[model samples]
Target chain A: MTSSSRIQRRAFLGRAGGVVAGGAAMGARLAVPVATAEESAGPAATRKSVAIIPPVAAVAQPVREALAASYQIRMLDPFVRFDQSLEEWAAGRRAMGDSLRGCDAIVYAPEPAPDRDEASLDELTRGTYDLLNVAASQKVQLVVFLSTLELMADYPKEFEVDEGFMPTTDTSVRRMSLYLAEFACREFAREGKLRCITLRIGQLANASATPASAGPLSVSPGEVARAVKAAVDVGFSQPSRLANWEIFHIQSSHSQARSSTEKAILQLGWKPDQD
Target chain B: MKVLILGANGYMGPHVVRKLAPAHQLRITDIRPAPEEIVNEFPKQEFMDVDVTSVEQVRSAARGMDAIINLSVVRQDPILAFHVNTLGCLHVMRTAVEFGIRRVINTGPHFAVAGPSYEQMDYRISPDIPPHPGIGLYPLSKSLGQEICRTYANQHDIQVLELLFYSLRDRHELEPGTGGVPFLIEWEDAAEAFRLALEVDSKELPSRCEVFFVFGDIPQMKFSNKKAKELLGFKPRQDVSAPWKRG
Candidate 1:
């Protein structure tokens, strides 16, 4: 594909329009229609509503704060804990469906404790699966699934794996679960039900520390919050593609083997804030 | 027909084995030994403990078989998931080509081409669309496996049938929205798709490497299985939804 086509395929809505408009201007003079009163007011005149699922996680708090700065934020209750009978699971699915209704978009960040055992892991898996289903059923326009950079563990230690590298062949439950979540989001995105942006986050520093830079390896919570906000903004602005999904490696900038931040920079207009 | 079935202990393994038992001579292999009931039921069929990830084991079992059907999958474990789903496929395709096996049937989830998120639920998705094999390791690995099949098919002139299944379970077990997608397939219907895939004359196949959506007919959903219906004669025998009206 031509570089221009690739950009059109991968660029965020606003930039993509600029590219198209640039191309059109060189071709022919076209009649422009007069703007209506509603059209003149611009997209910002109406605030887009975003529903944040399980707003209790550490990541969720920063993301919520960042999003609340621009969009109208709605916090869905914490997801039903995984250890429940079939009846309870069904009820939880229904409850999730109810919570997501009328929301323009959703931010899903399930925070299972780090020391979770097999049962808890299973719960996490099931909960994610159910949540995806509910989101689809509710017809939410965009879903920003918070995934971790741990998926990069399987990459050769020396290789600087970027978003373009295909996922490695690890089969650990954690990696597999994250992979499945990514799959579900992409599947929904492909079906044109919503736009899914998977932020493969790096190691998060303490909330208080102002990291000097977004090094290639690690990122701070504040950086993550900003990334989430950028993604949410793009999701609202872009017209969802039938196969509209993207994976970006969110990390601090580095001189060594740059953790390919080009896609995030170009698409989301996101640059890591070192200060 | 002499058929080698890998991952014969999975949920669909026994059903497939039982379905193919009457007409085809079968050799079944899995990491675990085949259950005794299956052994007793199909006394003529041979069972072997074969780990698909082990190229040697797979090569050994694949010898002298007319065709190979890969059912092996690891969903939860990342290491084994890649080993089995991706590398295992490489072994199967390579072995099939080496042994002059003409046809291979590979099973995978529908997410391979269904795009990741449900953002485009308004129109039907056909098999020909470039696969958007969503983010997770399972689908990613499986999609890679399909790529392997495509490579072998194109390079070696082998007929590779990649069946993209939505959800495969018994009719009684299927719920309204199986696997969180608007599509599902009863085990029997899935088995029938496989059987028909095996029976379709190679000359009739549109391409050497082909993908077919193997799910119960759900016109209401945005996925189309018309290719499977027209090419392989895949007649879905069960509709888990609205079961009372099923004929």
Candidate 2:
């Protein structure tokens, strides 16, 4: 059987419990020790090709810089823009498949925007479906899906809303779109069509210029991009710890941090930069 | 009560309309016109052409209604699935809030809450737990709508009753030995559950949004329909466990 099949088979075997205990939505994740040099999945000797499919160019640049040295990065904004007519989506999806042909993995980070409305959700689903379809067809090795921490904003402020906690989202189109997009991602991962690492980042702000909305939920874009790179790099790190699907909380360790990035820390070797 | 039934052309819509028509004032709306037989059966019932995907259309269709029963579902197409299954929900709830309609009945397959993630491993799962709607587009999209309904119910005064079902079989035609169905409800029995949901007082419910697994008493013990029985007083008339035969 292929590696993908092994992941698929493992998907059924490890889930003795429904959802991951520490991580919220990922199917099955295990606690494993760090791999030795020989077990390093992603060797830095040769840079791999990765496609960064963010919601916009603004979010793509930081991630590009983070992965520039470790992997050759290409941006595919259309895959997550959620702006396409039915015909346009279908045609663009076919074109997007070609764009993914040479990439080893895809980083699909779709953040909710202020301008996003309810009507754009159809496009959101279509875009995500297109990405997964194209990624599967093109034999992309992995897909790191970026979700938002806002989905869990409704949890009590004093509560420690770790990755294990269930996500709570409101009816706004912005948050709902992200919530829906994550579902699509979960399904694709469950099928084992593509190994996925869903990083639910907290209030994402630029490393240099903090957005006004930054607070306890704040995690610098630099940290998020680094997490994305670690998600892509092979140390045999995640394939061993994560099931075909894995969800990890990505955020800074604030005094009042809402999420726990323990799974990301152990599984992906993702560490948040403390300042 | 003046009820607005959206997507009244699906499999279970006719059954609900048939059951509710004599007592309640229903304005049935669907993208396609109701069959001549249905229109002819309830001459006094109002019928309109409306697509749930369009918020404006749903809003217009919901005018002067006391309650709304949303049965809109699109399982197949990639794009239309979200349009109808996911976004259609937002329109329904927004309309409910706008019209001061406090009662809304939402429907979806059991996988909307208990997908492969739960079904294969967990037995006797209840609908109240956190939903783990895995990869299938049909369930995933519909579950998204379910959440939207829950949000509206919690935020607004609207009462959303999500009745979940997986398999609907003719009571007499049930195949033997599980028939690859973990949960099965009689077609008519499933329709009756909707009526109970519609009639149950919103004040008596545990919360503004509640989920119930609407199925018959199956022998597989794969799920618990006790919540439906206790809350909505939903009792299946058919012997749903006949397929197992106790063999």
How well is each residue in B1-247 modelled by candidate 2, as lDDT tens digits? 8999999977788888998887899999998889889998999999999999889999999999999999999898777787888888889999998889999999999999988878888888999887878767788789888878988887899989999988888756776664657688888898898789889998779999999999888777888999999999988998877777743
Across residues A1-275, which tens digit of lDDT does each residue of candidate 1 receive?
44444334323211100000001111011111111111112255477767776545557678877877567677665443533455655565676676667667877775434344333333344455556657777887778887767667666656656787875424343544455456556666655656788888766655444333323356666667888898888877746422368888876553332255567877888876533
- Writing each residue's lDDT as its tens digit, candidate 2 over A99-179 gives 777678888765444354664555456457667877998989788888878778888776767677777677676677777
lDDT value, candidate 2, whole model: 0.74
DockQ of each: 0.10, 0.43
Best by TM-score: 2
**Predicted structure 2, TM vs. truth:** 0.83
Cα-based lDDT for every prediction? 0.68, 0.74
For every model shown, what is its TM-score relative to the native structure?
0.51, 0.83
Task: Please list the residue runs of candidate 1 whose C-alpha ends up more than 4 Å from where it truly belongs after superposition.
Answer: A1-46, A77-82, A111-125, A153-160, A207-216, A238-243, A256-258, B1-247
Kindly give the number of clashing pairs for every candidate.
37, 7
Give me the runs in candidate 2 sitting further than 4 Å from their true place.
A1-45, A55-57, A79-87, A159-161, A206-214, A234-239, A252-275, B171-180, B242-247
